[model samples]
Target: MLWFKNAIVYQLNKDNLFDTQAITNAVNACPFVPCGNTDSMRSGWVSPFGESQDNPLVLDNNGQMLLRLKKEIKILPSSVIKQALAEKVTQQEQLFNRKLKKAEKLSLKDEVYIDLLPRAFSKYQFFWLWIDTVNKRVIVDSSSFKQAEDILALLRKEMGTLALTPYASDTPLEKTLTKWVKESLSFPPIILGDEIELKDAVEDSIVVKCKNQEINSQEIFVHIDSGKQISKLKLLDERGMSFILNRDYTLKRIKFDNAILDKNEDFLPEESNAKLEADFMLMISQLTDTFKSMQKIIEEIITV
Candidate 1:
């Protein structure tokens, strides 16, 4: 599976961290624990090791590390909980031979919820990340900040004392993106696409999106003059990879043009285990290059 569609890059300091083994130990401590029927949720890490490749930690010749985490969550259906509680409430009211008070009904509901929690169905998801100790960066394989935070929060709980911040430049990204569209500061080697997601920085909630329209058109300039800062932008790199650059410096809506994707088709392994091995290898290799360039350009463009 193409597990990581986007990246949440972080600037990790090169201190306190000793070796890969330390991280491997932390991961081993928190393998996926199946949620019990009554439990609401249970989340933890996992070793994505298969029958053929059964190792919790994968280290390359360069010393870069990759780790996987599995989260299992279970939640009882609201309707089912309500039905059970209603039935109990009716029996209690008949026994007492009087109407139940609001506080009493609520208490009964809380008890029924606890009783039904053990029967909740479970769901599963996995998170994988790369530890670039050489570069002092921890790249999370997630699109949204909430998902990204889940990984970061867990890492801190496991390893302790992780002070990493989201990737960004000295100047605010929204301000820099506004300059790109208003003054048309087209950075060389990266072409701007005809799509944008603008927001009113003052209000923070107001937003405007322009799609398939010329980014340099006078109509867009009008919106720019009206204080709409660029929040999401579309661009194509030299290699024809297209992606949306969010103001937060996280990429979204990424698509490596078929030309690039088709090139990897020949090397895909037939065996399931071998294919996963090859896929992750190729993904980490290609994305490392793409993101290295991406981080540099963003930093340079936004910084004074």
Candidate 2:
């Protein structure tokens, strides 16, 4: 319930010029409207807490700000479409005394799509954004770049002149990561994980991935010797929070050890909201503390 499956981080421009008031204005600007019968998809802003729109869309969960974008999509089963298409084709063939032409079949599919949309079930998904204005970074809790882009696009539309850019640096991160492993890089409590991803410079298409093997082992060293550079590297802290840092600054994966549950005992398990808030405070505290070191390392290694 209080978990983020994935993280996609983006560094903001020097002018981090937006706040919850701006976001709330955007949320109120285009409230969610249900998908029309002819519409296959609908997306808009919604309250992070499912209760009321009046509730602040931007939450100050301790220090980390939480914003949510909600989308609804209508589902039309293929089997239903196929069956209807077959029936229509059979009827048309009999009327024309010939097979339905390609164009006619294409038109039929379009008609079927529009007809099925009304009866389709609406599915909802949320894109949770964690805004760290102090750090000038936005973290989307999604694995999909498309979903992450959708959130940014909506914000761009609502809060015009959003000058955020991809997390950048002068030197390539892959080379830095490679050097880290090759040199047995250590940042105290933040150690390199066994897993790594690499790519060839000459042939951008060439890719390699290794997991669960000693990072400094000769087996991996062979790849480094062959000119492979690390594109993504796994990192673990002393507290057992695992991170997968990408070539960009996007944090692809993060896992908290089960030991963290010990801190939750003070909060009653039945209190969902309290539990959520408590967990949020704990999670963010740990994450930001860890990320400070991570940010320092990135700034140092990437020539920021």
Candidate 3:
């Protein structure tokens, strides 16, 4: 038989029952009262002298209790309560383990494949770029940087005083080019010859002067990687004139020319590429770690 020990007894009024708040206040006010072991049992009688006529206490409307004390109230050690709680916690942990093992036995193929299919892409890297020529902008696929810049210039020239911002992606160039495409053509302001001065050149990248005198010139670098489908561009601003880097630049294909027209159907190819596989795997591992953490919480709850 289980030994029931370490219990608390609460004496309450026989009439004018107290609300939960009143009982809680009474418990807090009297530190010597024997409140139950669990938080939920704020006002209950312990069967210290075995079950008798006085099983539960009654409380007044104000949660006041007037009873003659048979003995002085004291804080008893909760050794038996602690032991019972420990046993209950152990049983819960065992149950949680069994459930987790069963879940692991099920297949995860469907979940993984669903999460992989609909290309996950972010534009966090290139959301805000200040262009002197155009009022608004969108990036298109192609190798001709000069043509794209010219189009943006014309658009800026047409839309005077409005802000022209470039839209770029937030992934590594190789992965972006494999699965994304642009579909519209809006021109920008004309590039003035005086605004074309080279500020600085680093390696193969050059900082080109921007047309707006209030803003600093944009730094541009062009580099090619062997396995990359498009050239990578790095933009920089020296003074307060530059916009923050927030998007990634990607291209559908590289065309070697400066006079390509802005009217054609563009499509980004999708293939079984390995460039982004490692990064994707890392993200998946993070999600798995979160799940394990939740399982640990359940184990803790059952044990306690």
Candidate 4:
């Protein structure tokens, strides 16, 4: 219920200024529209609070903002187009009593695409966007980096310019994670979870994935001694958040502890808007604490 499942965080430059009122006006001017009959895809902003005209295009709770991007793509299967193109090519060959050339086949495929686009089914995707002006952070609830970038790209276009950099540490994140597994690095709030993925340094293709097993077990150490490094590690925050830390420093499969979620259960399902607001506020608070802890961890690793 408006909780972030995964976070691809970006840091906004201090020099950049984000006026929420201006953004709300600009985004509302470009509300999402479905793809036209021949259009392959379309992406635009939409009201975060469902499709109700009563809700503002951007939901600003304090300095944090919630925005939604809706993208619609026509589903024209390549196989269908190929089959139709082949049929046209064969028909043309028989009509002309000659083999159809590659250029002619290409033109026929274009015709097939135009003819099928209108009849093609449509697929829709919604991405949640969170902008924390207070912390100079922008997080997208998307597991795929490409999809996250799509949101940023649109934001940049709408805002004229957006200066953001993907969160990264000076030291390789895997080194810190590997050290944690080896017990050489321990941060009190950084609790180990049961899932880890390791990859061989010499042979990049070699990988080992373990789930529901001790991260520091003898079996895991044996693989580590043989030159495997952590590629992904699931970790728990003592403050009630759990997420997988990827080698690239992206957080995936983020889940707030039930204890944290229960804090606002008093909000009834019938009170959807109020429930969403409570959830977002709680999520933002917990996540900011988690991020600050991560900053300390990154600093510690850099020194080590």
Candidate 5:
């Protein structure tokens, strides 16, 4: 049930101590709590097995660890604050028979924001963190690098000396991907999917996105021949998993095939905990295999 849609990966340094017990203790020391009356935002670790306090804060399945961070933000629209401030400024100006200065209006706006924050609506977001100890990799479920960094920052703060680096290579991914498509090169267990995004190297604004079309056809080669780099490409694993590979080595819109999803179908809906554990185990198994294949591709590209 808990599948990652987007992934921003990081490599863990060999010197760090990443035991399950140590992480669970550190994370539990600062569990998530509801926002206070005057608080505009709050974020902390929470149990991956839903919000129940009784559930363990971390789940370890065959050396793969799962953790969740919960963030709550107060929503106060700027337009509303601006309108209220304008009304207040107008009222003050009318009483004094003079226009309000910029500084005075700015002070009033701050007061308005503080007064409305407690009453403002609340929005909640959850980010999933997966730590692959065997592979020394950390993968976060976030669409943006900044968002992933925020979650990782919290984890690093809790653990006290976590070190990580983004996946990288000496060879440019754009050039390698473009070459793969142009020459129709095949990497075992990884095949081109129907979706691709091409962009001009010099003029970034010129981009082309293709869907449900052959990636190696004459039409696609035309763009590649014209010097457009592959900015994004959809790739399918032999195990039926698919994801969009970005130029920066991040993945987006990952989907697992039903063949793998149905492996735990026997677990009843009422057995929520069992079902969750089973699903996580299955999902991680497939992802680990996929990552191995990707590592091979990176190694091959570097050698080339």
Candidate 6:
């Protein structure tokens, strides 16, 4: 009827059962019986009047009665599950780090892509060119090897030849032009400590008025070291009009927003035109040279 109905049962021992009370007197002696049920009765011992079918006796391996219970118990709590998950995550992270280390070890060679636009000529005019460093070949658009070679030779004669050669498949002439300029030209380091008044003229040129004299249509070519590596050049005119030359010496294009300029007096037709050209040309020339030098160093490192 119950889950434990057929389980083995055992009894415990009474003081070997029960103890009787004793009294001593000078002339009389008395004895008393224990009150509660005796251990013998509790120990699965049947009375002489009771039948054995009502109570069955259980024995140990030695035929000795035992009184012990066995039970199924839960030892782990719910928090242990969270701890296990955290340990699993730590193991996964360790495995990922090991894999990354292995990948780093395998990557011994590095290849880099260079942007030729800013490094070659300051103004962007040539649309296409290619450089094959491995083959030592440079190709210009629609030009044969001889023509390309001759052009490069002439450029080198004027501005020294670069250590790196150009490839035929290379596109975007700016890239090759930048490389050549960086390797060949040398520019004097000039630092403009104070802001000079910038003016623009009818002609496309810029004029900067300094303390000493107004530099008008002044052509400033930037070169590094002794070689003729020209990264950028700026032509400033007396009327304050300026022409910015990129690494490739191409004229740079600029966009003017009427909405923004309309709010300021300096944006008037004449003033805006002069200021815009002068400012952009001066800034673009400096930026081109700075970037060109950095590019050359990066290319040298990558190739090495």
- Tens-place lDDT per residue, model 1, 41-143, is 7777655553132654444336576777677777677899889989998999999999999999999988998887776677777777777877778888787
Candidate 5 residue-wise lDDT at 77? 87
* TM-scores, each model vs. reference: 0.87, 0.87, 0.16, 0.94, 0.94, 0.16
- Per-residue lDDT tens digits for candidate 5, residues 1-304, read 3888888889977787567776777788878988887889999988888898799888888778898899999998889998888888989999999989989888988888888888999999998989888788899999899989888878778788778988877788998888888878889789999999999989999999999989999999999889899999999997869999999999999998989878888877688778878888788888888888887886776566
Q: lDDT by residue for model 3 over 172-231, one digit each (tens)?
A: 433322112111111111111112123222332443333433221222112112122222
Clashes of 5: 0
Clashes of 2: 0
**Which rank order by lDDT, best down to worst?**
5, 4, 2, 1, 6, 3
Q: Which regions of candidate 5 are displaced past 4 Å?
A: 94-97
Give the best candidate by TM-score: 5
- Candidate 3 regions off by >4 Å? 1-142, 169-248, 254-304
Give a tens-digit lDDT track for model 2, residues 1-304.
Answer: 4456577777777756557567667767866788998999888876665547466565676346777778899988899999998988898899999998899999999998898898899998877777776676787888877788888888778788567766666878888888878877678778888898888877878888888988888888888889888888888877648888888767767888888755886766567556666776677777777778876886766552
TM-score of 3: 0.16
What's the number of clashes in each of the models? 4, 0, 27, 0, 0, 50
Judged by whole-model lDDT over C-alpha atoms, candidate 3 comes out at 0.26
The CA lDDT at 180 in model 3 is 20
Candidate 6 whole-model C-alpha lDDT, 0 to 1: 0.28
* Full candidate order by TM-score, most accurate first: 5, 4, 2, 1, 6, 3
lDDT of 2 at 117: 90
Local distance difference test values of all predictions, in order = 0.74, 0.77, 0.26, 0.86, 0.87, 0.28
Q: Tens-digit lDDT track for model 6 on 129-167?
A: 222222222223322345334433432343333333332
